[model samples]
Target: MYSIDETYKNIEAEFKPRSKWDQGVKETALAVLDSLDMPETVLPDHFGSRRALLLNGADNWREYSYGGCALVYNVDIAARFFTPSEMRRYMADGHDASMAFRGEPLLDLQARALSQAERVISRYAREH
Candidate 1:
């Protein structure tokens, strides 16, 4: 149960201004990945490196290139508990109409995502 103010403070620290040439997407994205605990089977290219669980619609997952940008979210082990929309809705407090604009860095959102993942994984573990 984190207050918005505390979350904002974290966002402030995470989103430090970058030089004109450095837009902080991939690095932040990889940092987010570094925070997760995934199996080695997900992607060999990212194995043992990218750590955090990724739920996009945030600055950590946005990639800008070729005159466009994309946001990314993933659900593999916990995919059965909820659809991406449902999970994101839980993250967003019900409504997701503005999910794409929730540009908080991973530092702000990682704890919540990790807690949610724990719940989902616990359920799967118990049932299976």
Candidate 2:
């Protein structure tokens, strides 16, 4: 299994940042990855699948969602604040929330993302 640092480096090399928000998210993602303790044990399946999704997006620039933002958010949050089981639960809940609105009201998605960001930021702050 690849270490989280190795996985993150691979991701950074593969996904070019296009905007300030994109660049911030990428940098934050790497910071979150670096903060992980048992990075080798976390998100084995999810990380691989998400990385593949990102690679696909990189190969086809027209595909928007696969570009790693949501994947980064999910993995970062899971690594920082959740157990494997809770990670699955919250991720499914977030997906369900998004689907219930037919992707409109994007507030649900934004809330989920913001919650993840807040948690990761707070944890990083407390640790450092």
What TM-score, over all chains together, does every model reach?
0.21, 0.34
Candidate 2 weakest ten by summed lDDT: 119-128
Candidate 2 residues 1-128, lDDT tens each? 34555556555666575644445455545654554544554333454453443333333312222344333343443444344565466467446523323333333333344334333333332212
Per TM-score, the best of the predicted structures is: 2
Q: How close is each model in CA RMSD to the real structure? A: 16.9, 13.6
- Assess each prediction's global lDDT (C-alpha) against the native: 0.32, 0.43
Point out where model 1 deviates above 4 Å.
Answer: 1-105
Evaluated against the true structure, the overall lDDT of model 2 is 0.43
In terms of lDDT, which candidate is strongest?
2
Candidate 2 residue 19 C-alpha distance from true site, Å: 0.4
Candidate 1 collision pairs: 33-51, 33-52, 34-51, 34-52, 35-52, 36-51, 36-52
lDDT of 2 at 102: 36
In the range 1-128, model 1's lDDT, one tens digit per residue, is 22223322343445443531122332333333334334232422231222222332222322221112222342221232334665566456564443332464323243344334333322222211
